[model samples]
Target: MTIKKWFKSGSPWIWLNAGAIAISMIMVVGLLSLILVRGFSHFWPAPIVETTLTQPDGRQVQLLGELSRSQTLPAQVMREAGVDIPSDIDLVTRHLIKQGNRDVWGRDFVWYPETGMDEWRYPKEAMRLERREWGDFYGYPVRLKEEGRTVAEGEKLWPELQQRVDRANELFDEIRGIERGDIGAVNHRMERVRLEERRLDMDRRAGRIDRASMEEATVELEARRAELADEYAVLQQRLDQLYQDVRRDTLVGRVMDGREVEIPVGQIIRAVQPNDMSVVSKVGLYVAQFWDFLSGYPREANTEGGILPAIFGTVTMVFVMSIIVSPFGVLAAIYLREYARQGPLLRVIRISVYNLAGVPSIVFGVFGLGFFVYFVGGAVDQQFFPAALPSPTFGTPGLLWAALTLALLTLPVVIVATEEGLARIPSTIRHGSLALGATKAETLWKVVVPLATPAMMTGLILAIARAAGEVAPLMLVGVVKLAPTLPIDGHFPFIHLERKIMHLGFHIYDVGFQSPNVEAAQPLVYATAMTLVILIVMLNLTAISIRNRLREKYRSESD
Candidate 1:
């Protein structure tokens, strides 16, 4: 076709649209690929290098670390930063090394100029200890001590140290179980008893109960307190024993500075001699570390450890939001589409709902904080949990408030989708149902709503995708840096809606912006961002699957 004829037929526009879509898809794929590469590689056991770094004063110092990153910068920038870069060089490449004995060096990473580093070595006996606190330790194993006595040294120490580390880990797990599981339960029960006693006192002062009944309730509460105390005592004894066992062995290691430091066995989460590891061993360790990252809790101001809590909180809050929003959103859509009169009033309401979708998310967060938390939650605390007054149960940022806030924020999306779905239903179907002796409500409820279910699910999918990645709204409503306990636990009201939760979106923000060690937390930021993307995709896929099934079922029925 001629150029003018092609333009008239809109052929160029078609090709242009296809090109734009292709470009968009490429960009998305590229972004995800970058996140996956940078995030997933963080778990790999990179070889630790022992090298000599020449300081600007011509003094050579031993350095031990894994290579973190490298960047090329202008020589002038280096000079401005007080680095002794040569004027002859226009550009200087600097390397960031993760010298992870943070407690010893007071820094987890250091930047060194490429020209100043030399004598690189990878020793098989060099050790990397992933600790429970103060970050990783890079050193050479010198000896193993039992209590205060030296039990193994030289070649005998490695195997003995491994065995002791395993034992210590086991004891640590047992101790954690006692502290968080058994002892936690006792503590919860004790708190409940205290609250009950307070409630009883309030009732007595209010004349809601007579003296005889008050005495009986007080006696029962006292008995419950005594039982919980006994349970706590036993758990405490077991916890003490486990702590002693875990602390019984120590590993003596020589750091890069050539100073011998003693690390208690309990403090070491994992010990690896990366240079000595075979390819198979390295791969195995990589998988294990990634799994731990997925299942463990954050440590070191959220720079180290796994983000299981954040994952759990994100999924749980989304689930709760779906529960809260689905029914209300569907009802509102139904009323607007099927019941409400079609007039200027309805048009204005529809316009308002559509406008709400464009409102800033942080605005919704502020509204939720004021209206939902301060007003509604404060009222709930006063009415339902007066015994815990001043302590504020629901009157704080928590899972329920976060879910409610998100549900409200995404309500417009759900209502619009559902209304569109309802509009698509053939009016003939409604007329036929009515002709078959069905009332208007019955025709709408059984037939129209069922056909619109798939669209409702579409709205839910959109809502979840948006809510899962929202950090600002969550921060104001519920999310915290670290929750000592998960919202869902073995405690009473197994789902603790009032407790604050950790979220993947908030985690990325905190690690990326709020962390004390920016270099150490950089990889974690990518990892957490990747996790949030995956979580949103997963939630959307699940909702999409349901919508597809519903569509298929309805199509078959119509056929």
Candidate 2:
């Protein structure tokens, strides 16, 4: 066939589209593979290398670390950089070692020339200690201590150290429970009591307070405070006991330079002798660490631990936005497609919605802040939550407002999709239903809307995909660096809409760009981004499954 004939037959366009799709798929697969490799590999335990190196100035230094990476450079460059490379060699190799005793080494990573290294060995006794602060410690366990007194030494110290870590973890759990659980509940109750008193005071100033009621409230408040004070004292005692127990134990480790340092057992997350681990043991530890990353809360300025809060918040916000946007979007689309007259107003509305879909997300965020938070939320707070005045409750950035804002931002997509679905339904079916004496509403709901359900779900899926990855708008609306509590909790009226939340996308942004410890936070960024992508995929899959079911169910009815 001639080129002109192929073009006219649309074969050229089809081939072009296929090529574009293949390229897009390859790019996406490649990106996801890179993320997976970088993220999941972080949990694996690598053998610690202990080696001696000859410095360029003829001095020898001892080093213990993990071989992180290697690179090759021209011999001329190495000599020019004063690296003492041999003149005969065309290229020189150097290794970047992750000597992670950052507190002692002054740096986490260091580059050493291969030519200057000697006596490389992976010591079976070498240990890697993951700490709460000061980064990881690469050393050998010397002894176990209690309040500066040695309790165990040599081989016995390893088992003792493990036992103490387990004990310290338990104590840490108790401390967290007291501070964030029991104490948190007490604090919330005290805040409610304070707000109640302030409400009564305001009523008195306005000459609307009842004397008997005011006296009863005052008595109740005093009794509650007294009860809380007693509970607080008991919690304080437990906290003191935990601190004492935790601080008593310490692990003494000998570094590369043979400098012995004492690290409190409570401050260490895990102490692993990577060089001593068998394959099965290493695999088990790797799985455990990965699971911990999935379920744990972040620490050390979000450079360590897991992002459970972010995952919860992202899922909750997307679920809420889907719930809110679906009905409104479907209803508007139905009116435009089924009920509204074909006129200039309908055309204008369609144009407006499509335009809205193209509007910047940040612009939506600003609008949400101004109109939803400052205006609507402010009014609600004034009328109903006046007790918490001055300190705005609903009139602030929160999960509810974030969900609502995302719903508004993604509404246009739903409207367009639903309208297209409705338009695609044959008019003969509606006419047949009407001819059978069915009312317009009955015909539309039973015949037309049912067939269009799949399209509505398709729109919802798109909206969820878009909203889940959004960080810019959420930053302005409700997403924070850290959330003390989730939006949904055990509290009464369980879904607390007026609470700030952490989001995976925002967490990635913060850890990648805004964290104080950039080097430590870099890997976490990839991990978080991978997690967010997984979450979005799960949500879309659910929506798509529902859409598929609906389509199958309505296939015969539409025909």
Candidate 3:
């Protein structure tokens, strides 16, 4: 009767907890799946080729990207990027044209076909332009006659311009390879080696050799050096100007000037490369960038930058901290459960653990910044990385500090879980092992810890999940907006601890809030947000799977 009552009373509470957990799992999973779908959607879209036709009549047929109106670009877009135009001549109009300029329909691309460069969906890699029959009229209409201009004159200019650009680019590449003093460095070093030999020769024939001949040799060398140097400088300057014209990123006007007009992240990033002209290509670029944004972590120097290195930096620091904290947390839990006297002190320690858990993550961030970044890191840098000092490699918020802070924040959770797991093993288990002549240490290693592995792992997974989502602590410690270089590479053992890093949370915040072009960045921000959510969900799913497996393995049939 007592057993029946206990079972009946516990059933409702058990079902309630299970239901809550199930609901939460379903909600999070569904939301994350939706986000992942949307992010991936940005990739594959229908492909269409755009063209133009000038019939035997003077009428120009405009070929849009597709028959129906496309929300996509190059086909019906009136403004190819910043080049604005007539509002009515938009994507819908292009769709009307692509419908074969059908007389059956009042509006269509065929009747008034136009494959205008002005509304290019994307900059085509190669425009198959050749002298071909435009329905039988075989003449360049804009060509400049003896003293006249015709319809074909403008048409020929693009091919000519392309040729010139190719030649110019080739020249620029060659000249850029010529380094300052490269020729002279080799010559100068050789001269130094030959100086002693030359001295002897000169002494032997000082009067016999003409002074003018020596002067001429020196002048010739200098002239050759100056000629190469001038040619290189000119080519470099031209390349720099051309690069600037293409990207148009520097509102500075001069290299050192500054007065930035706010622009969106997508706009700026798109402008960085011409290949990002197509909708598909643009989508691809963003996906790759965001993937880097999501997976690697990101950071910047001051305000605007990426977060890949920061993720790397954070993970490295935390992994090290885990190695440091795991033993300490476990040992403390063991002593408290088995060795420490159970008294007021033990109760006070428990209270302290609770208080520490409640302390804000940002507080840990601050402490990490102050103690770990500054003092300990400063000391290490001063002793070993003296060359990089005053820049504050360790002594400012950084990876090491962030790890330590998170470790501190998570330590209590680990300790509390470990203690609980240790306590949960029936007293009989311990007594049974000891009764069989096993030492306490042997029991812990062979029995207690083994049975408690699942609980300990649960605590660890929770700690990791919490740490991965941590933003405030990172903000205080090492969360930078952008970083100049990657933290990992191959250079004499190769992990660069001094570098800053990026995080996805920080990236979404930057793109959504701090981006220069807020309007353009909106879609990308949603996309990025979706990506981050999917990643966090993936992590949680892995943890939950492990937990489920353990629960199935350990659940007692009697219970």
lDDT on C-alpha atoms for all candidate structures: 0.92, 0.90, 0.54
Residue 55 deviation, candidate 1, in Å? 3.7
**Candidate 2 residues 1-559, lDDT tens each?**
6978979999988999999999999999999998888888888998899889887678888989998779999889888886777668898889888888889878788888888789789989999988888888999888888998889999798888888898898889888888888998888888888898889989988989788888988999889989988998998988998899889998888999889988899998888999889999999999988888889889878988889999999999998999999999999999999889999988998899999999999999999999888999999999999999899999999999999999999999999999999988888888899999999999989888999999999999999999999989998888999999878756688899999999999999999999886767878888888888888899899999999989998896555
Q: Locate the minimum summed-lDDT window of 10 residues in model 1.
A: 485-494
Over 4 Å off, model 1: 1-3
Candidate 1 lDDT tens digits, 372-423: 8999999999999999999999999999999999999999999999999999
| RMSD of each predicted structure | 1.6, 2.1, 15.3
- Which of the predicted structures, 1 or 3, would earn the higher lDDT when compared with the native? 1
Clashes of 3: 51
Models sorted by lDDT, best on top:
1, 2, 3
lDDT of 1 at 81: 97
Query: How badly does each model clash, as a count of residue pairs?
Result: 0, 0, 51
User: Which regions of candidate 2 deviate over 4 angstroms?
Assistant: 1-10, 74-92, 556-559
Return the TM-score for each candidate structure. 0.97, 0.95, 0.54
